[model samples]
Target: MDLNLRKAILSNVSGHNTEQLEATIVDAVQNGEEKMLPGLGVLFEMIWKEASEDEKQEMLETLEQSLQHNQVQ
Candidate 1:
């Protein structure tokens, strides 16, 4: 069985509005289920593809700061 997870995820969210998408992301993150990781990754991939260079750099910096600040000492 060949399952295209990315395509599936995109299809699931195809017609979602901003609020719907935000709810989906919040639900996924708050649920903290391992199964939700792939969906989050798919969402991030779409964002990365559409992001401008400046937006991408901001995202990178924010992520870096988050990881650094939350690091386990």
Candidate 2:
């Protein structure tokens, strides 16, 4: 069996506009299900691929701060 999860996810949301995409992300995060992580990862991969170097740097900084804050708890 050949399975392409990323392609499947992208296809599922292909026509979604910004608002719909935002709602999907918010719902997924709020639901906090283990099954949603792969979809999130696929979305992150798309963002990372499209982001400029400076944008990527800013995202990394944000992620680092989040990780650091988590460690302090």
Best by TM-score: 1
Tens digits of lDDT, candidate 2, 1-73: 8999999999989999999999989999999999999999999999999999999999999999999889964
Residue pairs whose backbone atoms clash in candidate 2: none
lDDT of 1 by residue, 1-73 (tens): 9999999999999999999999999999999999999999999999999999999999999999999999998
The positional error of residue 71 in candidate 2, measured at the CA in angstroms, is 2.2
CA-lDDT, candidates in order: 0.99, 0.95
Which regions of candidate 1 deviate over 4 angstroms?
none
> Clashing residue pairs, candidate 1?
none
For model 1, the run of ten residues with the poorest summed lDDT: 64-73
Best-fitting candidate, measured by lDDT? 1
TM accuracy, model 2: 0.93
Report the number of clashing residue pairs per model: 0, 0
